[model samples]
Target: MELVINKILNEEDFELYLKTVESFDIINPFYKLLASNIEELLNDKLRYFTLKNDDGEVLVLMPFILRKVPYLEDGQVYYDVISPYGYSGPLFNQDMSRGHLITFWKLVDEWYKANNIISEFVRFSLNHNFQFYSGVLIPTLSNVRGAILDEETQWSNLKQKVRTNYRKGASNELRADIVDGVKPEDVERFYRIYISTMKRVNADTDYFYSLDYFKNIARLSKGKILITFIYKDDTPISTELILISGNTLYSYLGGTLMDFFNLRPNDFLKVEVMKWARKRNFKYYNLGGGRVDFDSLYSYKKSFFPNDEDVIFYTGRKIIDKEVYDKLDKIMNAEVYLEKEEVMEEENDSKISFFPAYRRNAFNR
Candidate 1:
């Protein structure tokens, strides 16, 4: 099939875009939500593009933000292009299978060389149960990235702990208002428990984005974003942010009032949302994979992912114009140009997930 690459200008065109990628999976919500977030949260504007065939088939989708590295500029400007700005390989039509994957990459590779754009990595951060990327090659990387897979078959019968917790939570009486809009104050209520949830687990809760950021996303998504509140006798106990895209309903972010353990608001709210999703004709709900390996959160997500699948991230590096990068490094940081041997030595000494410069600029830049 002959493929044509085109850029999308607005949400009005999104429905047409969906026709090309028919199988709505969990990653679909990631594409929709991230595009919404980047258009709002990013300091720079993001461009959307699609790869379609002569038969009008959209083989792959790429949505990217044009991020310029201030400290790493090469005078020749290019972007840190991540379509979706978060996870998954290029979004492809599930029906296409692996047929067009290599072709899609070839197109992408040629596009990068021609445009002088360098894509160091594409993060597959979506929470889904699908094992192995359906239509893409795992890029060359030294280490195996870790992920938690939720399989319904392995869990349909339920492990003893999963059965117990789910049963316990199932017995609790609860209700949710899964309406189209979200009040800033309602979200603020969620923030309270969200902060506590972070602290309880000692996870970093550095919320860099302003309140205005989320408000804009809710608006841009055209009511596809739903903020549900679980209430107990007029008191709100928990809240969830859910987005519908394609055939999937994604459980984005959730929090519960720390004091209302008796109400079991969180558990109640999830089941309620799952049932609501079922009524809406959504095929799958991505509750999300946990950050910690084999944690309670993983169990909770698995409880809902009946016959679910595991998703992993592959980091890609296409060193387009090495001459440009070399010169840019000399002007930027002393640490940017270390050899593989030195990098291995450094890795052996210690592991650091965040860089000092990037950490400083994460919020402001």
Candidate 2:
């Protein structure tokens, strides 16, 4: 059987791509409808590739953004294919045999080569959509657990300490409201608190999102994005942005005031979010992974799903053009590259762990 691989380029095919995503239950909200808004705000190009049967029924879809590698001059074209900011890899609706997977990958490799895509990075969804999809892609599974919402015993599953924090916040007069979409004022408040939280943690500048970014996300998500803001006497203390895809809610981005940390607003915020998801009949509330597995942050999220096992987040990277990749690598690490701007720093021959190291600091503002 011949599998037709189609690349969706302009608006004409983009409309069909969106319709196809809406028709299938194979992807999360990030890949389904939010990718467009994200691309618009980030000023990146969307590259959607799909595989279909001979009958024209779509079988697999891999949506990625072609991010240009910065600091490179003209004629030295290279790109890194990355999933848009969240959990999305390749989505497959039908069961595919090993042969099918291999053939699809071969065709994808050809497409990547023709497009000058030097490397690919993917973050797989935790909803079990693309699990065990082994072919040429290998993913590193993380030790993280997504908190499941159990109608019967979701509350009972929480750790005693977690419940105590939840109560503490309530007793301290902390409250939260789940808004349909993040309002302009709330976006401002969220960004202020979010920036403060980032500064508190000494986070890299790359993690700091602009106010316009949040606004665009809310606009793009349509009604799929929800914001729960924790307030202490009319003053916003913490806020979380949740993304709904199918029957699951992802606790995507959040921020809490460092001064009010003792009030346990963040803890109460999670409890309230879970309760809302439960009442709305959501199956899971994916409290995302921490900086490291089983760390303090992960432990806090894990306490909510005491009866359920931890969910592993998977990631994969593929080098599409090894020769071009090596050339870029050499250029990035070369003395000439470093001396181009008359920089003063000791050069280390040791390789950095960043993927396609040439574009490592591309996001550093």
Candidate whose lDDT is highest: 2
Model 1: residues with Cα > 4 Å off, grouped in runs = 1-27, 38-43, 52-59, 72-78, 86-88, 95-103, 124-173, 180-209, 222-225, 245-247, 275-283, 292-296, 303-309, 313-317, 322-365
Estimate, for each residue in 1-365, the C-alpha lDDT of model 2 and write its tens digit.
Answer: 34444445555666677787766754577875444454343463676667777887767777777777654657676677777667777676655654555566678777778877888877777755444443234434444444555645666777898789989999999988988756788778778888888989998876877777788667657678888999999888999888888787878788888889899998799888877877787777778766766667777777777667667766666787787777776666564444632332343322214565555444420
Best by TM-score: 2
lDDT of each: 0.53, 0.70
The TM-score values for the models, in the order shown, are 0.64, 0.80
* Cα RMSD for candidates in order: 6.7, 5.0
Model 1, span 168-272: residue lDDT tens: 555654557786666677556666655566666566544444455556557656567778888766777778777766566666766777777765666567666
Which pairs, if any, clash in model 2? 145-311
Error of 2 at 283 (Å): 1.8
